[model samples]
Each structure stands twice: as C-alpha cells, then as structure tokens.
Target: MDDDALRAWSVSVRYPGQPEPALADVSLSIGPQALTVALGPSGCGKTTLLNVLAGFVPPSQGRVTLAGAPITGPGADRAVVFQHDALLPWLDVRDNVAFALELQGVGRRERHARAEALLAEVGLAHAARQPVWTLSGGMRQRVGIARALASPSRALLMDEPFGALDAFTREQMQTLLLEVWRHSGRRIFLITHDIEEALFLATELVLMSPGPGRIVERIEPGFSRRWLAGEPVRALKSDPAFIALREHLLDTLARHRQANDKETA
Candidate 1:
C-alpha cells in the first residue's frame, strides 16, 4: 500500500440490526493524480464507502487512512460537496466561500481576497456578491466548488454533485469539474449512479455490486485525462471505445440487479 494515498483496506460496514453489511471487504486507493469514481446502483454501498472515507461513519472491519494517518472523524484534510449546494443562504457568494477561512481566524481582507480568486477560477467572479438563493442550481454548485477549494483540503470528496441538475447543466458542470481538478491538483473521489457521467469523468472507475455490497470490477478509462489534454468533450464521449465500455458496464449492472432479485425471491 502506498503510504501517501487515501486508502480503504478490507473495509466493511454493517448498520445496526441490518441483516447484511452495506459494504463487505472493500478496498480502494485514491492516489493524488487519479480521479477515482465509484459507480453503482442504489443499493450498492457507494455512499457507505464515501462516508467511511469522509470519517462520517466508522468501518465495521479494517481501516481507512490518509497518508498513513487513520481517519477516525471528520477533519480539514477532506472537503465534501453534495448533490444540492450546501451554501449558506444568508451569506452572499464571496462570504460563503470565505466562511471556512473565518472559522480558522483568517483576517477579513485576506479571506475575501482568497475567496474572490477561487470564484474567478470557477468562472464566477462576477457573481461574488450575489445571494446564493438567487443563483441557479449550477451557479450555486460552482460556488460550492469554490468554497471547497477555499479549505486546505488535500482531497475533494463529492457525492452525486451533479445529480440534481438538468441534463445540459449537468454536462456543463462535468466540464467545469474537470477543469477544476486539473487546476487545483487535488485528489477527487466522487460517487454517482449515472453511468455516462462515470465513464466521462473517471480516471479510475470502480464498479460495485449490491448483495452485501462489494467491488465487482475496476478499470482506468483515461477519458478525463484526454479532456485535460485538450480533446473535445463530445468527441471523447462519443468515441467507439467509450461507447463500448459504457454498454459493457450497463450490462454488468443489470446482471447484478437480477442476481439480487433472485436472492430475495
């Protein structure tokens, strides 16, 4: 195991009174340069694994660590962005992003300046003074990303961050996220039920199964790095290799669902 990577070693999670574990013997490593994504159906424990990594939940077995340190509770080393933008409605864009810095006792001038730079990076500098509630879903999410960047987090952990947006807006956010990942250089660990989104954004994609959930497959699609290399998003997604892998993954998911149904029956 690489000491510098965020890792889950033989992790398992079983909720109280539950007959089956949410996750079983799952292991994964997220290195600095990889965009690690966990893709699965609703019961496949994607969020469970993410919560373990976030230190929001403890593993029933084994351990989760970041750069050799055990993750016992939530810490500043990881920032989470959720499906809905968890912005402070009262604080305008800039203030919301600066909120983290405020908690750390950053000076008024310094925090706002840092927040402004982050907003510009997300292409939202002009909206810094706008109320968060007045902004559209996608705009608010951009602010959320800016806020995450404001923290001194080493990794960005997102849970279905684009799931609430319309198709067009989701696509736009996907591109923006890739750009942010490139510039910020932070390790990304995102979970999603959207297959196409997973295929497009993951450098390392983990396919998970649901009966006492566990990893079924893992692959490095390399599409994200291609986008960073200046390839057009549409062209990359539509490539024959991309389409074939998408279909293969879809079939794998369907088979898992069938097996689970049979077990219940």
Candidate 2:
C-alpha cells in the first residue's frame, strides 16, 4: 500500500444559501489497498465527507488528490456501492452486472462472460438469470457489490451499503464484504452508522462529530490480518476488546451531543 492514494487537505463544504458548512476543516489521507470506515450519527456529515472523496460535491476550500495527482470530477478509477441496489428491473443479474461494459459498446458475448464470472464470485451464479425483482434485499446488494467489483477500479467507495438489511442479512453482508475486501485489496472507503461493522471492516476508523463535522477521532482496531482472514467474524464481534471499543465510540458520540446541546443552550 503506497502513500498518496487519497488525500483531502483541509476540505470544507457549504451548500448554497446554507448558514453552516456540511464539513469543516476535515483532513486525512487513505492509502492504496486499505479499507477505511467513516462512522457518525445522522446529519454528521459522514456521507458528505464520502461525497467529497467520491468527487461529488466539491469542497468550498481545499482539494482531494489521488496518487499525488489532483482528483477532479468522477473517474473510472473509483467505483461506488451505494445502499440502494440501483439495479435495473428489466435487466437480469448477469445483464445488470454487465450493463456498464455494454454501455462501453463491448460485445454481448464478452460482457456476459465477465458478468457471469463476477456473479459467481459473489455466489450469485445460480441466480444469474433471475429477475432482480425476485431476489431478496441481501441478494440485490450483493449484485451491487458484484457490479462494483466488475469494474477495474483502483478504489471502492461505499455509503452504508448494508444499512437497509435485516440484522441477520446485515451480518451476512458484512462477512461477504470482508471476503471481497480481503481478496480485492483495493482501497475501500465505507461510510456507516454501525461502529461494530466499521471496526470489523476498516483497517482505519474515521470518527466524525455531529452536523458541521470535523474529525473527532481516528483509531485502528488493529485486527490481525490472520483474524480478518478467518471465517469466524462472530469471534471478533464477541471479543471483549471489540465490545469495549464499541462502547467507547458510542460514548464519544453521546458526549459530543451533550456538549453541543449545552453550547447552543
């Protein structure tokens, strides 16, 4: 993992006619081949920060760069997995995965082949021909994951991609994500409200404050590569260290809220 992958230098953003910035003076860099998670409460600028990284809503001040080169607009080098499946109902699983390639005018044969391979990777091989309307919530999200993986992107940005799933499905998606992340080894920036999920997935955690956000904390769970490689994600989830870490972060958010309320009052 080389340095200078993604760096946001003193970035800040204010929506037109808004009194306060969505994000103010947030600075950090993500290296190549790492999974980073941003965790915060609602309206805490968590997604806004990701929008900056994904090149959607440019910051009013400062800029973001990739590989020492300034990042402008969106590029194919970055792929995003939004919470919504965003799959076309008319398209089958394979076709949905291949849609991007087809848009580039690739031959149907080659595109379908590539799509099948990605579907297989995500355990959706049998569902390749299934209508998206028939698939479950988790299945659709896996399709979204496959679609992102289908692209040869240098980085992956995910915004609470599992937020809508039931608890069981959410856990399953988390494990699947870890497997894909371990295999792809591409830089992943995941925005989430789940502290436990963030710890389980991210090599580094970025904690943000409430609205008009700034970096409140940065910590690494330091889960060993061996642990992440193992199948027992539940072990990590149940570990005392993990529980303590979760409590600490939740407490941190509570304190921020209390302080902010007092300041305003």
Candidate 3:
C-alpha cells in the first residue's frame, strides 16, 4: 500500500446545460488507512463527488489530487468498484480478478498467482474456476472487490457498492469489507445512502445536501475501530450509542431535505 492521501480542493461539477452544479465547492480528504463514506440522498452529488475522486468526471472548477498529482482521468492508482458487478461473463473468477493485471502486461503465471492469492483473501479461493454467471450477487461482489484489490491502486473508490444486495447480504458484505480494510490498510472512499451502514463503516462520514450539492456535516464515528478491536457486528450496531447516532443522522437528513425543498420552492 502506498499510503498516499487523496484530496479534493473546492471541487465543483456542472453538466452541460444544467441550471445548477451537480457538486459545489466539495472538499474532502481521503487519507491512507481511513474509510471515508459520503452519505446523502439522491441528487446530492455523492456519486458526483465519488466520480471526481475516481477521475471519471473532470471537475468544472477546482481539482482533485493524489499525493499532489492532479487527477486528470481514471488511473490504476485509484480502482473503482461500482454498484453493479461488471465482470466479464466469458471469464472465470480468477481471470476476472486478474484482468486488470493482464492489461498492464503482467505475465500469465504471475497474474494468475496474484489473482489466486487475492481470491483467497476475499474468501473466494474455492470459486476460482467458476464462471461469473454462476456466482450469487454477494459472491459476485466479492469477486469485484478481489479484482479491485488486485490493482496496485493506492485507494479503492466505491459508489453504492452494496446497493444491489439484499439487506442481509449487504450486512455480510459490510463486515467482509471491514475485514479487508483492516487487513489491507488501504484508503477507501465510498458513497452510500444507508445511514447505519455509513456510521458503521466510516472512520469519517460526510453528509451532503442537494440543489447544487454541498456537504452539510462531517462526522467521525469510531465504530469501525471498535469492530476491528473484536466487538461483534450485531452488538456494535445494536448499541445504544449507535442507535442514538443513527436517529440523529436521520433527523439531520430530514431537516436538510426540508430546507432544500423550501429553498428550491
């Protein structure tokens, strides 16, 4: 892991002909070994901010940088995991995980070895030869995550990565992601609408509001460290403190929505 910090400086984005910016003056830092989650409702620029961080969409104003280098476009240094698993149907699990390495001209044996190790890390070693269509939704996401890790990326950027999974499966994936984060110690920036999930997974949580999306609040919830320190997931989530914080965040989001609606009206 490179431990390079990813940063956004007064970033803003506006689609052509759009009356307002999709993201306005959004600034944040994704430090090495920290899990930063962007939490917001639809059209709040969470995805837009993630895209800017991933270099998928260029900011109309301001800039994003990794270790002081400008993020002009997507690079292997920042791997992205989308809400949907975009695996190659024709390829088996191992090959799919190694696909990026192959593109980088890594030799077959080396890439395969690395892919197999990553599969084992994500608990998919047994499914190495299985085709993509054969895996369940959660299994497929594990493969996606394995693939992302196989990259030499300094940061992993995820956009609603668990949005497609059922509640139970999403929770399982969240636990698995935390384990991976603990083991890998790589920087992560994830966007999500799930309040509890954000609170549970984020070392730092950012709340955003729409109508030229801007951040409303930033919270540091230490639940992830507690989980890593051997606390059970269920217990952590059910803790009184956790419940109280969740309710507070929900109320905050509702208030923001009401204010935004009034301003637009």
Q: Per-residue alpha-carbon lDDT of model 2 for 136-162, expressed as tens digits?
A: 999999999898887777888999999
| Clashing residue pairs, backbone N/CA/C < 3 A, model 3 | none
What would the per-residue lDDT of candidate 1 be over residues 1-265, giving only the tens digit for each residue? 5668999999999999999999999999999877999999888899999999999999999999999889999989999998777899899999999999998899999999999999999999999999888898889889999999999999999999988899999999999999999999999999999999999999999999998999999999999989889999999989999999999999998998898899999
Which of the two candidates, 1 or 2, achieves a greater lDDT against the reference? Answer: 1
Cα error, residue 106 of model 3, in Å, equals: 1.8
Residue 95 error, candidate 1, Å: 0.6
Among these predicted structures, which one has the highest lDDT?
A: 1
Q: Ranking under TM-score, best-scoring first?
A: 1, 3, 2
Model number with the top TM-score: 1
Residue by residue across 1-265, what tens digits does model 3's lDDT show? 2336799999999999999999999989888978999999999998899899988899999999998889999999999999888999999999999998999899999999999999998889999999899999999999999999988988999999999899999999998999889887788999899999999999999999999899999999899999989999999999999999899899999998898889879
Worst 10 residues of 3 by lDDT: 1-10
lDDT of each: 0.93, 0.85, 0.92
Position 237, candidate 1: lDDT = 86
Ranking by lDDT: 1, 3, 2
Model 1, runs deviating above 4 Å: none
Please provide TM-scores, in order, for all candidate models, with all chains considered together.
0.98, 0.95, 0.97
